[model samples]
Target: MTTPDSAAADVAAKQRIIKHMNADHHDSIRRYVEAYASKSMFHSRSAQMVDIDLNQMVFSCGGQQAVIAFDPPMKAMREARERLVQLDKDALQTLGRSDIPITKFVPAYTHPAHLWNFTQCVLAMVLLPRQANWQPGSLLYDNMLYLVPGFASFVARIGWIVFVYQPQFQINVMGKPKLALQVPVEYTIVVFADGASDSLLHGSLSFSNVPTQCDFQIALARVGRLEKGKKMKPDSASRTLMGELGLIGSQKEQKREQFDYETAEKLCVCSVGPPQESSGSKTAKCEFSLHIPSYLPATAMLPSVNISYAIFATCILPDRKVLQTSQDLRIVRETVEPIRLEPSRTVYFPDTSFAVRANFDPPTFSSKNTTISTTLQLYGLSLPITNSMRFTETRWLVPREIRWVLEETAVIVTGCPDTTGHLPMSSAQRILKRRKLATGREKLKLRYPFTRRGNTPVSMHSDGSGFSVPLTVSGPKDLSLDASTALSVAGGHILHAILDESNSDLNELQWRFAVYLECGLHIWLRIGEDVFDEASGNLVNRKMDEMAYTIVCPLTTSRTVTGQHDRGDQDEPVPMIPPSYDQVWEQPPPEYATPEGFTAAEAHTTNSLVPQDLLG
Candidate 1:
């Protein structure tokens, strides 16, 4: 298995190997290409190192390609170097060219010492469009190169030694025969490797007419700032006075200085054709491949710092005028991974006489419809009852409505702080504050009403025995489920149950239930009662009991196979079992609190004055 640290180390090792080869081993790479890759009958004019790996090196020259493999997979850069040296010696002996001198294959251009010391090598290169003012008859061709750091430079040059024109007459708009214009242009593209490092830079030039000689140079410059502590040069009298007063060591104002260095490098160039088309202007295209350096930071846009790279091209016209254009390049890093999670088990409410269990068919679901199963069993003290002179009756305990809710919370950074003393607020906070103000209206309405609201009531037999009810609830089909994120402001869901309130006028009670199922499942139940307050002439909601449960939801995964050889077998869905409770009561006695603000007589009067509006 590859740990994060090991993966990082692998990336760093590859980067070091690439930089060393591209910066200092250009000649060695060319030799390897000739010895291991080139054939005697098919000699290459120019070879550029394109890519390298543990197993092999790939090179390209013009349209031809070749690969040279290591005898044993290279574990590091040291082994790679030793293997290259051996291959070079073997290649020379095999070709019977052991006497060839290294100097005979010197590159056409080389960087001067001064140009090699200015700046770190360019990280990326891009080509921009040519100037629009060039002669219409002369055609200019542009090709973009994606350069990876630590790759050898690619060079190409083309010129015409002489021009022979054969003039042809053409009819003009005015019906007069006119001679067509003919122009000759020469262009060169040179991608140079940084002498200090394996970074690459591009240089290109085009001229209206063939010149005596063509030259291309790249000037790299770096500007830096320096801050120096203030230096004190006290006069003789002041120094003596300050020494006597013990003030000679006092601080002085600081000084600042700015300095810059610039260097220019002459790129290698090659001469290419004597006019493929002799009578008209022509366009030539060239392309180079660049691999982005693994160690380079991605392009960033920030207020405090800006780091960017650009490629500049200058065309020296036959008249000694220079035409230049620049293009910006971007560096980025991207990674991707696929993840899978195990399913969960069914969970039950905790520490209560009331029995309840909730579970989903498949604990984990993608964007698909899933069913939730719930079971309830009530006995002695948990069952509700209605009393009358003719008969006393007990009823089943079940929720009137249920809802699956999705909520989100986020950590947001405000763009800027307020100039005044007020604290900054995020957009989500502002919206929440507004909603809080309307809580009275929103909370009073029924949020999720039962689909079959007016259905006939099912009676429970009272033979001194407990009963159980099993129900299946399907989640809404419109919800979008995401398993890729943690449960936070942008990623969480909950289930809520609104149990039916006791309708008996004598008992003014309500219960609210909620379940949380993320890392684990937990249940919260709040028991509250409505009481009329005669002293205040209003109704009050008093909380009586709070219960909590830690439960589990069984996890499952969907199985769908798609292949000619698949057996197509699938697992059957698990059936939900009802929870079993040991006891039930018509009206469970409330846990008592001291009646501090009202007397017992007043409480009786308040209960008697309960309005019809408060009954439901």
Candidate 2:
């Protein structure tokens, strides 16, 4: 007598031996022969092969073994039918809670023998059944099926499954026809096709230790509810009987014909009235309008935004074709933010550029050539500051005025806002990261500072750093200049230059123009080219400077422009040379009076690619 424990031990021993034999590298041919001989004997239905050598080896020695499934054809059918009925019950219970009600479970019989033969190529024991239900006034139907997990491992039916019926199998001793089944009698296991025809349903569920005989009541909510049902077909809608059993089908058929016989919707017919003819030539005029919101801050003053625009126009026609034209147009708008006047100064609009774009459809386009033209205008302010009414000075108003064109390009910007107090030195370092002023050699020739006449001496002083003086304009006027001025510094100081001035105080005033110009350049460079770096918030208050310069330049432009004209009208002012602002600018604001807390501009790291003279 084989006890469950003995049977399990035998199976485990066979499995161990099979695994060992399979792992042995006795060559593929030898392995195949041994496998075939051993597997065939175990699978043979004849009892004669029960004691065969291969079978004995598997039973006693081989570590691995295969299982022989025994599911009689008649028994398979009966279980499948039972599963189908169970599915009908489950689905009815599930769908019935909704507006839909079960009408019947219709039996559908197909040639199981034919299906089984075809399933030989695959595996799956399946039974399909139709389910009928009623909706409001209509009868709805769906098809569902049950499948023995492993029997239909390869067999699949398309589009027929609406639910699955899983039934347990056990040997019946007192039954009329005793038969062996492939399923365990413990669990209800089911598998849906999931769009495949050759899928197996076996071993999907092992019996769980849940109480099977608990007298717990199962309300309608016990089963999962079906998704909302689709609208009933017009052919299925029904009507009430009048002295006769009027069928839903008849009513649906009548309604369907009524729907089919309906006339086509009457064409919308109100007349638009004949198109009014025009006497003049059909020369349609297209005027493009651009409306920029006032929110855009000015660029000249602090916290200002200066915008320049360029427009590229394109016309798309009825036939998926385009006619395009592009033009660069500069737009200058003053800052809408209010300004508080401190000294005397106004914003200046240097000749700059902006961007714009336009679109036109067929009606706006013409086969005849059309032209687009663009022009740029800059506008700003001018404010005057009252001096101590000092002694008068004399200078030249020459056509070639001794002007200092300190051309600086903003290399980068770290968009940090100013804090309530002093910014840490680290803030400046981040803004200046990776961006070094172009060396004089790498910068274009026309962009650098060189006197039109003889070479002029150039001196630069940043923060409290000593003047790099008398770097005599010793080279040729056209000669490219390269300066190695990365003198290490202690803190964040701004870039400033001193001209050949007699009095240092007067000299400081002369450099204001250059400082503002550098500020403008920096703003554009940082806003357009650099990433927003926050760590650089403490150094020199970088972000607020940008904002303040932008606002002040544009907001006070009217005063500045006026002052420039007024100064121009007066007798030629002295050709004031640049002055160093190392002390004043580098000085910590009154709020931050610590003498050592000077914010020195970052040392212009040498970029061999950029010319040093570019910022001269």
Candidate 3:
């Protein structure tokens, strides 16, 4: 029954779909082949979409072809994008992974605030290699480290290693989008009663972020150990190796290694090969990179989640002695999506003819009370001039008011997931939701919201134009709103100075950064939805309760990082307004205030403690 035209349309649509999937979402294509198509041939390395139809998609995975059909074939071409997202979600769940597009790891050492810390780290690196402790059974191993305060925390690992070299860290992209961590380390083996166990370098990772710190445990590069499925045991041998030599330092250090190996047996590892030892070094030296699997929920603090990664270099001796040292890992996520330079959106009412276009100045925001230059253009407002009577109609449509609302949705994760991937009792709280700009109805035809713009002489012109310039709305040849009519118009919004963009930290508590930021713009129009006039094909409007509801604008927000470089400036990080979502960030705090406890003098203190932001 299909016609030639319909067949051609289908062919074109399939080609476009295949090209997009191969270019942007190859990860999904790989997953599709592994999950639905060939399991052994592809090996999840790479996949390309060669062709697609309404019912199915054909992929070439690792030179192997796969045809994955839709459940009930797609009826239209536009449904392809949404269908792919759904399929990706299913693929991720099946692959036991999450959509964590972790591109790179960022270290805090580059920041000026960590200068003293970095200096000490450098000092430790210099002193470690020159000392006897870097040698096994030197007894004096880490003896000097104890004399200094935080030095032991860096170079010392518990187990069979005596002297250890402070490592230099770098990130190598194993394949595209994989952050392979490379660390160079040198260590002297501890000479036991029998002999030094075989030395192997491994790493474990943990991280934490806002509202609370999340205790997600992850182990990395556990190479050259017991068989892949076997777990590490904490025995007297691990203890004597800690106590007998200079290896034993703290009780906390002893339990961590055993716990990491036992609990994180199923942790994802992209590549696991024995460390390549260098023949040139005096000590057992190995320089290797670990291709850490993406989205491994770490422990410590990151922008998305406050989490840190650790390394556990273990050696199972002939006597089963284990050696190790761990440190806090600092990592930052790379910007995946580019920031919009000009966030211009148009709002159209299907029942009306006049369209309202909104333009927000790019990335003009503050920690609180951010002032922005905003403009709303009114278009398609007219009644046609008559052919015979030649009567030109002139009328005005005015905006009643404008306002701003800021919302914060905070999410908190609790216990580890069960076998079925169900959380025991994780929750989130809405910490802040308040209106930064409040507007009330005015007797004037046009009510323009006004606030200060940086160093500009005036934020608005007499005719309500921005930057103190004269502006005329394009309309009838001789029509113009006067200075008084335009003076009150505010094309921009102010994120009240007291308002804060969502922050990602609170020390000690086990919380993850799950707070999302959003803005709601309400434009109250003096004119309601338009009505059609049958005579001249013109649209007119009748008045209703204008203040009852508002036309909301979807706005895009970004953060500005100011740098004072000697020359120009460093490349600032892209501002990310975490995607708006309603998730539990924290368990709701217990209500402590009672009539007797609530007093006037303690008001300011109470305000500081409680999230008293008014509901928007």
TM-score leader: 3
Q: All models: lDDT?
A: 0.31, 0.22, 0.38
The digit string of per-residue lDDT tens for model 3 on 384-428 reads 434433233223333333333322211222222233333333332
Per lDDT, the best of the predicted structures is 3
RMSD (Å) per prediction: 26.1, 34.2, 27.2
Instruction: Quote each prediction's TM-score.
Output: 0.24, 0.16, 0.27
| Model 2 CA deviation exceeding 4 Å by range | 1-282, 295-308, 335-411, 414-517, 520-616
TM-score of model 1 vs. true structure: 0.24
In candidate 1, clashing pairs total 29
**Candidate 2 local lDDT, 202-228, one digit each (tens):** 211111111122111100000001112
- TM-score for candidate 2, please give it: 0.16
Where is model 3 more than 4 Å wrong at Cα? 1-261, 265-285, 293-310, 341-345, 348-355, 360-375, 378-401, 406-616
| Residue 426, model 1: Cα distance from true site in angstroms | 43
Global lDDT for candidate 2?
Answer: 0.22
**After superposition on all CA atoms, how large is the RMSD of candidate 1?**
26.1
